[model samples]
Target: MSQIISGLGGQSLYGGLNGINSSSAIISNTQFNNPLESTVDYSALIRVLVTILQQLLSQSSDNTTRPTPTVADTSNNSQPFNRSNNFNTASNNNLLSAASNQNSEDDRNIDFNILSATQRDQLGMTPRERAILHLWGRQVISAGKQDGGIYTNVLGADGTGTNWANKAEVELVKELRAAEKQQFGGDTGIFLDQLYFNLVKEKTGVDMSTRYANRPVHFSSGAVSIITDINLLHQRTGLTEFEQGALRLFGHDPLINGKFDGSVLDYTISNNNALDGSRNSSGNPIDKVVRQLLNEDIQDDGQRNGSSLMKSVITILDRLYSSN
Candidate 1:
């Protein structure tokens, strides 16, 4: 019987499915030493193999354009990363103008509580944005309920809080930690700050860090609730219009659009199954929203242009918040 043996250095492999003792299976090195032997096209063979390997690599790669990473200067590495130049002068001026005009309108006799679509249009906002503002206002009024209450309460004189307020920041921090783990494989402890900044840029195409520099890291349920309070939103700082829109639509809007199965207001948070393709499960509304938003960029890069549903919502909100 013929045995398969390891060849010496510089010897090529030779084997075949023949009789166990067949000499035809044995390839002698002397075959190549023969001067009359014809030469094989080794270069052509190599090129063909290389081409196959390259085609395989191309096939395995995801057929989508990945999102471009935003690079910020981390000069003061000692302290937590606090970015500068969060937004451009144009957006800042527009926000300031809108806020100022909205405040002035509030001072007038016409009640915002009863403002119609026409009235909102006169204020330079779309019906959808106006609806979001009104819904947000109602949520603020129901602050003691499951969705929690206002965090800053700039509009209210008492500045009272819901049962969820005391733990809102803590809960938000926990939510971010979990999201960081799921999205990027680990929590950076600075995920919230960085994400908030990114959201600002995504929404307004400007960097806006100073507005939220001293703001508390924890976000209230209202910040993530589907229904938001327009008056309370105006009173608060730190959050950009884009971030606010994301909170409004994350998991909260499914019911409004007939997409969510359960109750409209989910009081007790559970596993938060929104981003995991299981939308029925309950958890902190804010957490679910954050996960849903961040997961869009993490899962596939091709859809990044419209990455999260929040991106579309933010575009609408921007027009509402704009001077035009």
Candidate 2:
């Protein structure tokens, strides 16, 4: 597990504190001499870690209703923790109204089932999407990252993002819109755009005007690397299904430009203007973790930065174990 956190071949993916030593060498010139013992069993590893967190969360609470453990919203809400009553049902039913209420009764028992691969597809998420949800939730809950629980963080506060789908899922909606644009033209594409905008605003209380107003809502700088890979592979041949999916997930269209749209290039003027600012509206908690992992070099400020995903994950595990 530490290998996963610290990374292999002396490349310390799990960096240290913020101010320890910014200039210290994190990796050596050993080259690829130390290959991994074997490919990491991501599925099994994630399940074990998530299960441990679930057990700890369950044990910590004495609620009569048996609330499901959820991620807290990091933006807009100042509360340390936001709870989801159950994952089987939408935590924010108000967002979905009849849609979630109607479906929740049927899906209410499906929350715990998400850990199983067989049940995963039934939840309408791709492997990557579910993996992001599982790993991010585990990082937040079990790792004790200050972003807190699943309900507010990953799901989006008031269940706007989490209602029926998550931030990852919302991102997929944008991709779907992009696909519709390619297939139907700009008018139809804008229709889909409005559809999602209304849905997100109606349910989650977030609007793009507000979300992107102060801070540019780029998922992470990692998308730049991903887009480069996609453009390179796409020019060679038709993309693989997974690759195509990645393109959509990142809001890119091969049919259009090899480069990303202005939507993708939206940059923040300052920390105050950024979506993570004091008034962030649509920053996804899971996306934050994913971005951190994908972004380059966490050691710039050294070990003092508690925001590092490695430190966050380690802190979560430590808290759960100590509490037990």
Candidate 3:
């Protein structure tokens, strides 16, 4: 056995099995003669061989069949993350759409054509009356008064009695002169002084005189007198014939009262609130007639062409003077 072992390159039994030399497991000559010692070496070698066989079996099992390395499918693994990202993107888009819709709703809530009750109360006039006065004031400002002449003469009271078109025209002219003197401080140049004062008060909340003190040229002017002449006033004001006629009839309708009432003149010229047909204080659609008039005047292109505005004034007059 020793010769066979030496023939195998003097390797121990355990070393031979593992393709290595082990001096401790090598059978010695003296240990082989002692049967007990030889038996002890063989037993130790058997134990080591058993341990190596067990290790080899474990290694073989590990090498042949691993747990398949549990390789993750990246495509499947990223699905939840991708889904999370998509969900987040969709949520953001929904939020943006909601915000845009809210903004549009807010924009739709604004109604520029309608005036509030507080605004009507502060202006102390009906919407129709305010619109009429605003147009009239603009006309007066455009057709300035005469310079260096009796204001009454400029208003068709030349005493020649030739300029008077009719008794009605003559009466209207007299009422205008009286209103200019009594309410407007005889400053016929500043015909609609109250309108100007109200506009200044609305804008600056200051006295009209204080605003125009440094700029008196803007306060009053003598450019072209046209208040007494309807045709001339129309030319200056760009008001249509029907509109001018409506305003004239509003001032003096012989069919309604048959005479010029100073109270009517005052109410027409002053900023006093109109009691009749002024119930649409909130500018709501509850007053369909007034709301329709406002819609036509403010929303329609006919307002620019003077057709709708004429209709609005005519409707108001028709309501007031039922005979017309």
Candidate 4:
């Protein structure tokens, strides 16, 4: 209950120049100071968080079947009690009450299931694959004094790059696919990629040919700071998670080569060649909150200025059908 971000999470406690800004910040910075915390145990933290979520979801599901109890109408409690009659209305009332509470909780759980699954798929992840997407490590690379010694704007632990696992999606998929085919193949990222692609298409009819056209979809900026540490779990948090995810995506995977592969880069220049007529078929919904966050990072200039906050949400669908 200390509210400290502990264990194996990728979140850094460094306050940048903010200096001791929050209690959570202080705890995280301590880890940074200690060389022992340099190791990144992704499996441990992921398992812990996933277990907690599963337990909560199970409880919620159980609540849905709980029987509702009627409130005691105490107006007729004058009846005498015998050894057998001890099972009075009071006991019955308590049972009913408990059941009703459970039912209410179940409904909430159902809603959460839908929402979480939807968001994950939109961002390209499956139900089982939905989690803190990150290739976490203790690599704390500060931006140096020129970039403020720590990109304060880049959210998440050790800058924004350490949070989300927006690793070259295609390369990751290839690795996973190879794992599946070969004995050394690890089907982890590949299965995740497939699951995500299916979910988004089911939810939204939009396709890659329509959305990206020829444009490249970079999650964030910088050579290594493309993926946001915001995690798919909290990407819908808007100014909080939205910005963070964008940072992670672009920062970790910028269009360094300026070359766009049709399958790899969904956006393109259609025959019409117009931005306004373009319809993004992918799952990335430009919510009001997302707009606000992007506005903070992006500027309104034809020159395409600012910290290049125009981040892209790389849909997993492309990889599933990409020629590359």
TM-score winner among the candidates? Answer: 1
User: Could you give candidate 3's per-residue lDDT for residues 1-324 as a string of tens digits?
Assistant: 554543444332333334323522363342566665555556765664566556456555555644442112211232321212122222322222222232221111111124343333232343433432433433433342222123333343453335643333334335545666676555343434444345435533446445333322222343244344445655665554444434442322111112211122222211112221123122211124333334554566533222343444435333322321
lDDT (C-alpha, whole model) for all candidates:
0.35, 0.31, 0.35, 0.29
* Model 4 ranges with Cα > 4 A deviation: 1-188, 208-243, 246-324
On TM-score, who's better, 1 or 3?
A: 1
TM-score of 1: 0.21
Which runs of model 1 end up more than 4 angstroms from their true locations?
A: 1-15, 22-168, 171-199, 202-205, 208-278, 281-304, 307-311, 319-324
Between candidates 1 and 2, which one is better according to lDDT? 1
Q: Distance from true position, residue 148, model 3, in Å?
A: 13
Show where candidate 2 strays beyond 4 Å: 1-187, 209-228, 233-324
Candidate 4, position 235, lDDT: 38
Which candidate, 1 or 3, has the higher lDDT? 3
TM-score of each: 0.21, 0.18, 0.21, 0.21
Q: What is the lDDT of residue 317 in candidate 2?
A: 33
**Local lDDT at 254 for model 1:** 29
Q: Residue 249 lDDT in model 4?
A: 34
lDDT of 1 by residue, 4-100 (tens): 2212112222322223222223322113444467463447435544554454455445344676631111111221111221223222223223322
lDDT of 1 at 54: 53
lDDT of 4 by residue, 1-324 (tens): 224453223233221211223433334443344457656455754565565445445555655665553332231322212112223333333323332233221111111112333332432333333221222110111110011111222223343334434434333334444454463222222233333334334433435334434332212223223222334323322223443334333322211111111111111112011111123212333233234434544454433222233323333223212322
Worst 10 residues of 1 by lDDT: 72-81
